[model samples]
Target: MEIRTGELSNPHVIKLLQTHHNDMLKHSPVESVHALDVSKLTHPNITFYSLWIDNNLAGVGALKALNTTHGEIKSMRTSSNYLRQGIAAKLLTHIVEQATLRGYKKLSLETGTAEAFLPAQNLYTQFGFKECEPFGDYEPDPYSLFMSKML
Candidate 1:
């Protein structure tokens, strides 16, 4: 898969993001469903990426600058057809590398506490992320699982 910086104009990537938001709404509480839409992802502080395999969109991920030293993972989603094929892993590695290169000292994310999100939680765990208190504008919700990895 090829991973590259993306803009909101990518229709396929935008659709996947919308699907991710819908999926989160189905399995997570309102507060725990933090997937951003295209407009939000296009903000200056957010860096978005898209993964393509065979010229088809495979996945997408984003990193949002929370502060000079910290960043947050946002809108990470693997296409259903591309799931379990290391697409998310590669995208994650790319995001982490970008965060480190940008001088971020910590990377944090919040995913749902439901089974639907267990795989994502596992992916983060493999990268040394551990449970942490909510950060940024988030509050501690039963459906929210906060994790952070020091870079």
Candidate 2:
């Protein structure tokens, strides 16, 4: 497996992100889904990456610069067929390493609080992320669960 930058135009990458966006909205209320779309993830402040295994797209993740010392993890999603295959963990591990390399003192993310999101929350917790108050432009919402870890 290999992680590569760019390739945003690749068919598999686009489909994976579309599924991620759709799932977020499907599981969470419209107002509570904070997942970014392809355009949002394309910002200059954000870096997107896709994981490939034998040239097949396995997962995708992105990191967004919040400031010089802070960053946010966004759009982490593994293809349906790759579920439980450690794809998400690998993408997350890569994002955290990139955050550290960028000199970020902190890395944070927002996920849904619904039962469907428990696995994701647990994954973040396993990586040392703790519950936190909402940051950035986010406001207080019961459906939104925010977490952060020191890089």
C-alpha-based local distance difference test score of model 2: 0.92
Instruction: Residues 38-131, candidate 2: write the lDDT tens digits.
Output: 8888899999989999998999999999999999999999899899999999999999999999999999999998899999999999999999
User: Candidate 1 residues 2-78, lDDT tens each?
Assistant: 88897569788878888999999999866668889999888999999998898999899999999999999999999
- Local error of candidate 1 at residue 34 (angstroms): 0.9
lDDT of 2 at 80: 91
Model 2 pairs in collision: none
Local distance difference test, per candidate? 0.92, 0.92
Question: Would you list the clashing residue pairs of candidate 1?
Answer: none
Instruction: Please identify model 2 stretches exceeding 4 Å from their true place.
Output: none
**lDDT, candidate 1, at 111:** 91
Model 1's lDDT to the true fold? 0.92
**Model 1: residues with Cα > 4 Å off, grouped in runs:** none
